[model samples]
Target chain A: MEQVYKRTKGIRDDMVSGFCPGCMHGTVFKLIGEVLEELDILEKTVTVQGVGCCGLAMEYVTYDCTTSPHGRACAVATGVKRTNPDRLVYTYQGDGDLASIGLAETMSAANRGENFTVIFVNNGIYGMTGGQMAPTTLIGMKATTAPAGRDPKVHGYPMHMCEILNQLTAPCYLERTSCNTPANVRKTKKAIKKAFQNQLDGKGFSMVEIVTSCPTNWGLDPMASLDFLEEKMLKEFPLGVIRDKSREEEAV
Target chain B: MARKFMKGCEAIAEAAVRSGCRFFAGYPITPQNEIPEYFARRLPEVGGVFVQGESEVASINMVYGAAQTGTRAMTSSSSCGISLKSEGISFCASARIPMVYCNVQRGGPGIGAIQPAQQDYFQATRASGNGGFRMLVFAPATVQEAVDMTYEAFDYAQRDRNPVLILADGVLGTIMEPVELPPMRPEEEVKALKEALSDWTLTGHRAEEKALILPGGWAGQEDRCRRNANMYETWGKDVQVEEYETEDAEVILTAYGICGRIARSAVRLLRKEGMKAGLIRPKTVSPYPYESFDRLNYGKVKAILSVEMSIPAQMVQDVELAVKDRCRIRTCLRSGGEIMSREDVLKAARELV
Candidate 1:
């Protein structure tokens, strides 16, 4: 039997093999493209990718893509969405890009309830510039920036973005999902689809924070990275729907 | 067809509306707050969008977003606010997004004062941010000119695919003058003009043809820089200035924007005192109206006094470069938000004469 899978309409043919072996970013990107393709809104979608390893996301996914300065993806997306309200706009940001430098832009955009979607990729460490200590880096995680492990006294604790972003009343959808196992990966895809669907329904400011694995940055092979995410990362950052306005009666 | 007495800020807002601008995003600042306030009240009546952005940075970014969709969009602020807006301005310039920005200038190296000053001349005409890009800078002298130029700014920005600046000062922003509103252009004509530029705009792509791709980052870095520089060079050809009795005058008063208005008043007073003083008011500061000064008798003109509201910071260098050893030059200015009065300028001219 043939494997039932196909690339999204805007996915570049040449960028097919650039992803590291078993990288969750590739899976998440493909899932986002699939969601857009399913909704038939890929043609009018503009994705603003944040600065980090995920910053280069525009190169792979082929819809009208724009890259903003580190942590400013949401602000740029706000501009795109407000100007072209007819078009669907979204931002894809990593932990460092969203939780650190871009926290202000993200928070403000969410608070304003800008009509856009944000796909937040929360890997434990900063994967782009040699595995630095990210705001989402869990306690005792051994990465390049925190070789002695993350210290709450010095660097603070791992940030729960889904939990934090959920507290705000503006966002229509806020969920935390994982990509460490096949079942969880399916659940992550469902959450990603739901976020995009919220934008389609004209619900404002949806975000799906996917707890993904960074094998290269985690100093592990593909399987070990998945194991790390399942055993440690998920334990530190729990997986659940933190906020879903679509489930509320008032949202309807 | 309606004639009304209006402040410079109000005129700018009215002109923008008359020109079919439907999107305005701005943060309130002294002198220029009137522009935003006017738009906030007026825009909704005409089915336009007016957003009071979180900050000047957010406002400009909002304009950038709106302009990308091929809508006529604008933002207005003062010196400190404009300083916050430079990054978005540079982005719009690089992206070739058409938008209007009104800088109601105030005194400042920082937040110097909220009163009138022309200290932002260099900032407006020169590189406002980190890039080799030039915005179409129009220095409006009177409240009437501020209104007219603001309407013209939208046309110029779309025609040249660049950002346009209406460089007014606090005096012009606050002062009142009679302004005859121009006849409104048909919306279809404005839409046609925007559609004509669709070859380069992000207005969705046709099937089987590649979309007009804009570089997002330093993806093709050097090539992008060269392309932006060439666009600046091509657009710089339309620099303009107004020459007043410059032919036989012995001294030239070189000023621009609101400074030019004050200098004109002072020039009249100097003429009454029997001195052959003339005024050279640059309308386009970025292109600097270099050719206008080239026609003057540089050797015969005793000196060129560069009068401004800043510490003679901007026009001084331009005057020095233009007259270069052909004549003596002096700078008279009143900074820190203080408007240099006609009496003060005449006093300075009398001493020099």
Candidate 2:
């Protein structure tokens, strides 16, 4: 019998990813690796890794990667791209890294129209730090910090990044997709590809927010975590392209 | 190059460009705003990148990123603004990223005042950030020295793979003085310099090779700390200080930055009066010219006086440690943005004697 499928060249075959079993980071990393392979830009691409569960994406991804202190990946990515304009640079950031401590950097980079890509993985809880309440942690969700279900009165409501970033005029693309189901996972991959393509075309700032899940941190099995992300997380963060300016000339 | 009367901030900006600094990121802060302003117009002309970051915190990280790419990068801010950048500076040091920054210091233990003061001497020399990491610090007294120090800082930073800071006061930042600018670094030279760092820069590498450059490099916490300690030990060899008229003197004066210049004037006045007064100024305050005191004629010197722009005196502690109580030490301090006057330094010297 012949093999039907082999690992993508964009990812290193010999290395084991540090992400936990059933964690969606592997799915997202695989998708990114496939995208890099499809685009054939892995040789010139660099990944700015954020500090969190997403930081370990470097272990699996073959492209050059540099780590930034917590929440500064976008800012670092801006520098990397600005200095090496010919290189394709992107930041792989988790919910806490992109939303809470790094909110200013994300908003400012997008507002300035920095020429880079931001792959924001919104998993609702701080997975690496053992499930602390993230800026995107849903209301009534239980976290290590919020022992008794999160209350909007104290914890505040969850932040919607795509909708917020879509309000900015400079972004060439802004989309919110998920990896919960086969269909949604395909859509998320397409969204990531479009973001990367926007950078290659010199279109300006592009961001793809992918709704992912943390099975271990969510206190659920892999299947239940996917279901939770589909039913609950999707309610807070909607899926689909929120902004696309690449077609503005055709639309006009 | 022909000498031009330039403002301290503007000269430092041009010197940074001449030093091959192609990436400049900064936020507007008092006494240092002109630096970013100059780079905003100049950097684009030289095919460089200049970003006016939303905050000091963002600006330093931007430099941190650019430095990781092996580009000569820099940022500037005043006293409290540097405090805002402490975390990123700490990260840069921990990661062994090379970059330069300037502190056009102003009065502050808090948001005290915007006028000139050397109150940040302790902050810049002793504890720039949380980690016990030390940077090569240069305290310049004039626009010419500031320009020279700022230009040389890039080389030192790249040589040591560490952050180098220019500690200048608001007076030095805002004042105009004649300065002979350094030659502009050629574009090809800049590219070649960056290319030389390809082995360590954060560029994409082959899949089989390990390309990760972690903070303090592939070592555990304690081991990294030990490596950092060893690096500092090597850097200790670069300790630099300037001694003026100390030979055959009975009383010696010590200061840094603008205070040192004032003490130099006081020493001149004391020397004309036939009194034996000399001056010792530390150029690199961290490696700090302790040996300058060690080489002093302790048999002739009666006492040491420190002049500074801070109340309760900060640099005096370092001076005391250097002198080791071989001679009496006294301090003349002017706080809350008060400039240390030469007359006050002269009077302090007289009292010490």
Candidate 3:
């Protein structure tokens, strides 16, 4: 018998993940694990996860990691990267964690160009706390908090993190990705790898924002959530690499 | 290093370097400003890193991250800044990361004043963060004491795998005095110290027993906090206090930080006046010297006077706990950046006698 594929060494073998069925966290986690294992930096990396679902990485990741206080993963990662420059460090954050409560830390880390990677999962809702409206929630989307759908006059518009970060001069890479399709999943993994590679190369802050689906919160099945994602979420958070210094010369 | 005259905050920073603190993250605030300033200039020279973070919350989180890597890390802030840092401090406690920090305390209760005030004693010893976690807090009365305590705090934090605090006031922070500084820790020694912590310190993914548990190594919140409570119980053996001339005295003067120093002087003045006055000063305010008060002969001591710069008398609550009302407790206090005067303490001791 020929073994084509097996589990990634990047995730712990003894533990089962707590991600909800149809949640993209499982898919994104698999991608990050595959990328870490492929790069062979599993033993050389330290991860800081912000509060919310992203914090689950602290339990399942094969590498040593810490779950910082809500919204401070970027600051914690900044500490790790600045002090242990030899160690590969990254932060996995949610939209609520990064854009809402931790905007100061995220913006400061990005502006300072701290040499680290950020895996931002923007699922348009705070999944861990029971589907509250998130900073990335679509204007017309109804969350637990915004029962009648997000009103622009009251709740404000969804934040485009990649574009916001693109305004900063220090970022080495800024990309928005998704996991709604196999090709998009591959691109998300590639974006994560590039973000990690930027850190290994001693480049400044790099962020790969993954526009994901939350089936339970979206009130739809996993497949239907993908349909809503492509039909709505993509329109607001368009997928693309907002900035890549590596392609500066080519673009110019 | 030889005895050198230096500002209290700057000397504390230098002492941290000598003690092998290789990482510092802090924000700018009064009195403690010299600490970040000194680190900003000196840390790079010693191959250490210094960051003037966007805020105290961010700065302490940075220290938390750095300390996870087995690095000797620290952060310092003033009263209101320390209030802002409480969130990160609680996080570090939750994670059980070893690090040191100092509060060159200013007036509090919503930025009450920028000058030194002893108003944060309750905040420091009671609820630095919400987790019921305890830190070994050192109350230094002089520049020399501040330098010495800051120097030794790192080793204590590393040994217990807990955070330690140097509680100083603006007067101690701004005063220039000569200190017999400790010898500079060798770079190799610092490296080895960090390496020795590799068993627990975050160093990337390791397939080992330590790597198996959740971060902070607890089963749940109750289990985590209960374990820390157990560790704190053992710290009863580590309480440090200075009891002076209390064998047989009619009045016992008790205080901490600058107020303690003033109380000591008041003792001298009371002695010169032929009044039987003694002093009980707690060097470690957290593991407070409760036993010191137990050792006092209540039959001989008629009154215990609590002197502090906090108007409502924060540390006096501890003094009462220490005395347990066996002796009458009195307080001579100042607040909002007003340093307690030896004369006021002297008069209060005379009244108590």
Candidate 4:
């Protein structure tokens, strides 16, 4: 059997093993690397990593990488894309980075039709800064910020970014997926690849929101975390293509 | 390449495109919105990028990020918008990022009025942002100058690896005049710039080399501070100014931006009347043509009249400081979006004489 381990380009060698076991950032990072390599875009791509657990994503991606202030990755990526239209640009943001502090930036960038891909990870909590409840954290679910299972009466319901982005006519593609199982991971990878390809085709904004699991934050073992993602998280954040402007058969 | 009648703001936008700017991010503000509109239509045609940002703050940061990738990028806004961009401007200055900013002057401390005013002179020339960092400020009086200086701003920014400001007034932005556009630099030249500045730009690592990490934090940060100061010193050496009819004149009129044009008209009237008044316009506000005052023959010049369109006058202080006891000084100003008329400047100069 062939060995499966490999390091992504542009990642800092020392910080490669920092992700918590079964955190899913590492898996998503690997998936992104594979997509970039397969699409022949690794050399021409620049990734703007947002602050959060994903901010440390610079450690796992070998392409050109820069980190933005918390929740400012969309704005930064807009700059990078506008500056060098020939270069493929993308931003990896977490739930907290996208739905909370960066909501304005994310929505405005979408409205402006900036031609860049955004990979948003909806892990239901702010994993890096401790298990704080994120904007996408499901109502009735417990986390540091919401100790008593998130009460909708006090804290709003989970934000569905895919549905929100789908409402914007500027976005050429928008999808939601999960990475709890092998088949779901394959679907998530396809969604990410399509997002990149849309940019290469000069299509406007594209995004993939991956419903990932934070086992350490959820207080669940790796397998239980996967089960929680599929059983609980998927119900709140349904998995499907919310918008696909690129598909010829799809109706406006 | 061709001559066209264009507003100063429109001409500035055209010049930016001709100078090989591939990215433009700005929010719509009165007087300068023509610039972003021009880019909205032109940039996409060139396969470039144009974004109308959420705010001036976001727009400037977008320029900052784009410039870090070694591309020609710019943003334009009015006085209030510029105030919001101060933080990003300082960051760009500290990072030595090459970007162009266009400030079409307007009145007031807060959304004073959309009409042309020179009240931002102090903000543009001094402490526009936090830190002791200085920007190369170009004060364009004519629509033609507005367009030409915009191209020059980009060149100066790339050459100095710092932010450059094209400081024109609302009159310059809104008023129209004929301008002969210059030929654009080739794309290859801009790409070559990437190679030339690769040492500093935050591009990817070269083969077999450790990735260049820009030093962060307080450790040895003083050295970076010193480097920024050194850059300002070097730029000061190349200050630009325009002088007219100083020979055998008893009074000198010091002005910039639209006021400079008014001063010129006033000087013509004063010269026709044989009152012996001349004009000195500081084209670059930051380096401020300090030497021009040195060149003035104090023996012939009796006093100096500083003219501008602002209250609690700003540029006058610089003029007084520059001349400092060499000659008596008085200021003629119009606050509340009022322009200093030619007659007003003439009356002030006559009184000083």
Candidate 5:
């Protein structure tokens, strides 16, 4: 029988993935590669990979790519996108890289409506650093730094990046999605595709925040992590389109 | 090609533009605010881009991004702000992307003052950032020299695939001087220069070849470090120094940046008094003019008076390293915002004699 599916050319054939089993980063990265391939802009794309597990993309992506200093990917992408306006630039960042250390870089870029895309992977814990509490860590989630489970009194509330950025008028599109199920994974891909399309269309900032799981970091089996994600993670970061500038433009 | 009166910061910015610098990302800081302000007004006129980044950290990283595109990019900040940029600068150097930046220095161990001081000599030459990476740090004393160094900095950066620093002080950044501005490079020439770097730069296309860059944290860096060491060695030969009447002088004054400019006057004053004195000034402080120190008539020169704005004498350490106890070394003092007086330098020289 003819093969019904195959790996997208967006990923490097020699790509060596070091992602842990049950980690959703593999799924999210595949979606980005596939979306860039589907959009037929693979050759014109440059990936700005942040530190953490997300930095693993630096190893696998076939596109011209560079890793920025931890938390500076957004700012770096701003420079690349501005100077090479004809090129498609996007930054792939995790919770610690984005919402923690790089929050100002992200917010300032979003506020300026930089014509680029951001792939924000919010797994609620810092996985590569052995599961320290991330900005998106749930109120009661246990991390290496919050061994007794996160306490809001001391750790503050888990940050909702999409909701926080939604206050800015600059971002053209902001959406949150997950890859727990096949259907949710497909939705995540769609969200990612739309974000890229907005950038290609010269629309302002577009972001697809992927609510994901860190099974190893959470000290749970991959499948159990999904259960926990759905039960608790989604409550703090409900997945849906946060804003669509196209809809507002159509109304205008 | 004709001389024009210009302020140091604005002159450097304009010279950078003429030198084919098509991208600038900087935040406002004292003494260097005119750089970003000038770029904001000038870059768009030349079809270039300028971003007033949210912070110096963001600003330097923005330059990092622009450098990936092989565009001549730059950023500027003062003392503490430079400390913030050191992280991004180190990344740029590690990634081996060519870019230029300027430090219109203010006095500081920590935000010491808004006035000019040569207090960052060590930071500029030794520890610009983490990672033991060194730059061809140009300490231009006069506004005209600042303009010339800023103009040529981008090419040196591209040639070495390294970040270059124009280490200026507030005295230079704020002063106005007449300068023969470098001719503006044609726009097409700038494009061609940027395109020539496509083989290694991040052009964002894979039809030919994909370029992957790992900043600072890449494995197999021993080879890169070796390559950088070779480059630093080459810079030793290229070190530029001006030795005024060191042929038969007993007291030679040593300094860089504004102090160097002042020492030149002191040399003339000492000559008027029939005291054999000379000046040795290093134009580039990183691959410092150690050879110039060797050329000093150790047989005749009894002392090297190190003049600087920093009290504890930062540049004197380099002087000591260069002189290596061959001659008596005395420090002429100032700190924070205080500029050196020629009389202080002469007093220290006479005492040394």
Candidate 6:
């Protein structure tokens, strides 16, 4: 063997990740890094991360990184992209950061068709804040805020972000994928890469919602959490492409 | 390069472009709506970007993002809109990103009025945002001053890697005057300016390199805050004040923005009556021209009249601090969107002299 296989150069070797053990954020970060390295955009990319466990991507990502207030990552990334139209800009936000407090910014940016990418990590709970109820928490899911279980009458149903964004004419790409099984992990990586490529092509707004797991927040083992993501979360938020206007742009 | 009649808001928009500002993101509001409207039609002509953001909150953060790339970016809003931008301004301050913004102020405490008023003096000079951070506030008295101060505000922002504010009022924002516009910056010069700040900007760097922009969320922030305090101290030398006819005066008048311009007219009228009167106007309100008071001939000066277009007067506190109670201090006040007249200032100066 020529020993050609190695770690992606898009990630920092000396940096210590701040994510908890068995957190799916590490896997998502690696997928992003591998994609950036393969696409040769690691040097020109700027990452704006929200305030959460996913926001810790600033420490591990090799690109220039910025931190936004809890839910303003999309707004901040919009600033970065509009100001420096030449550079590649993206934001990594958690479920609570993207779909809850930041819902206004998320929708507005998508409507404007901002030329950037958003990597939304949907882990069903707020991992950083001790598993608080997220907008994406299942109808029966339990959280610190929802002590017993989520009730649709009071708590409201989980937000389907990709489906909501798909209806917008501005966004050129919108996809939902999971990181549970090896096959699904491969698909998630591909979706992330496609989103980045859409921005590079100047096709306007793109987003990749990765259905992830939080072992500690969910109070389950790492393997059990992956099973839960596949069995329950996948049923509600089906994994597939919801919108792909990029294909139309290609034909033009 | 051209001398043309223009509204204060329109003149500021042109000056920002001439100063190499390539990014403008703003939302529309009364008194300041001309700023964004002007930029929308003008920035693209100069190879710049202009975005009418969804709201004041979004517009300011967009400026924050653009500024990190080492470009001159800015936004403009009125009193209430500025309240929404406070959070974004705090983030820019903590991150040490250089950007400029303008507040064409209106009467306020909460949607008080849309007309001209200087009620925001306390808000602009004192507590702009959540942090202990202070912005170098420029209070322009005329459309000419508005053009000049706005052109230089960008440099002040880049010098300290912080935010600078041009605090005008609705009177200055909507009124028209003739201004000699500065020369438009060449495209190459704009690129050079951005390149000059590359060492600290968030532009893509190699894997081994690090860009330290945290935006108010960071570890070991105590040390970073102390560094900011040291920078604030140096602003004493950067203070700008215009002194007119202060030599051998019996009474001095202190004001800022349009109030300063109105008081200047009052000074001329008082001097004609053979009453010794002078004017001390601050161009930068944050690093206030406290030294101008020290230069006054205390032996000849009897009283200092603080004139402003606000209720119960807010700038009196600063004037008192500068005077140190060396002489009598009186405030000529107006509010509820009322413009302070030259006659009122003359009346106040007559009582003191």
For each candidate, give the interface RMSD after superposing the true interface residues on Cα.
2.7, 1.4, 2.3, 3.1, 1.4, 1.3
Across A139-178, the per-residue lDDT of candidate 6 in tens digits comes to 9899999998899999999999999988788999999999
For model 1, give the RMSD to the true fold: 2.4
The docking category that best describes candidate 1 is acceptable
Query: What TM-score would every model get versus the actual structure?
Result: 0.94, 0.97, 0.97, 0.83, 0.98, 0.96
Off by over 4 Å in 3: A1-4, A249-252, B209-218
Sorted into a CAPRI-style docking class, model 4 comes out as acceptable
Q: Rate the local accuracy (lDDT) of all candidates.
A: 0.81, 0.89, 0.88, 0.84, 0.90, 0.90
Off by over 4 Å in 5: A1-3
What stretches of model 2 exceed 4 Å from their correct place?
Answer: A1-4, A250-252, B216-219
List model 2 lDDT by residue over B1-353, tens digit each: 69999999999999999999999999998989999999999999999999999899989999998988899999999999999999889888888889999999999888879999988887898789987889999999999999999999999999988899999999999999999999998999999999999777777666766356566433387877777788888866887778999998899999998999999999999999889999999988988888899988999999999889988789999998998989999889997878889889888888875
Docking class of 2: medium
State the C-alpha RMSD over the true interface residues for candidate 1, after superposing those residues: 2.7
Assess chain B of each prediction and give its TM-score. Answer: 0.94, 0.97, 0.96, 0.95, 0.98, 0.97
Docking class for model 6 is medium
**lDDT (10s digit) by residue, model 2, range A1-252:** 999767888788887887787788888888888898899877778888898987776667887788887898888888889998888899999999999999999999999999999999999999888999999999999999999978999989999998899888888999999887889888988988988988998999999998888999989988888789888998888888888998784498
lDDT by residue (tens digit), candidate 3, B102-150? 9988887898899889989988999998867999999998899998899
Model 6 steric clash pairs: none
lDDT of 5 by residue, B182-241 (tens): 899999999999999998777876744888876655477888888888888888766878
Tens digits of lDDT, candidate 1, B1-353: 66799888888898998897888989989988899999999989876788888788778877877777677899999999999889888878877788999999988879989888888888887878667678889898988888888888998898877899988888899989999987676778767765776555445553233233343453676787787687778754777788998898888888898778889988888888889899999988877887777788865688788888888567788877776677888888889967788887887787776
Clashes per model (N, Cα, C within 3 A): 0, 0, 0, 2, 0, 0
Off by over 4 Å in 1: A1-3, A142-149, A250-252, B197-200, B206-219
What DockQ does each listed candidate score?
A: 0.44, 0.67, 0.66, 0.31, 0.81, 0.71
- Give the CAPRI class of candidate 3: medium
lDDT computed for candidate 6: 0.90
Candidate with best TM-score:
5
Candidate 5: TM-score?
0.98
Task: Estimate the lDDT of model 3.
Answer: 0.88
Per-residue alpha-carbon lDDT of model 3 for A1-252, expressed as tens digits? 999888987777899888888888878878888998899888887888788877776778777777788888888888888878988888888999999999999999999999999999999999889999998999989999999999999999999888998889998899999998999998998999988888888878899999999998889998899899999999999999899985673477
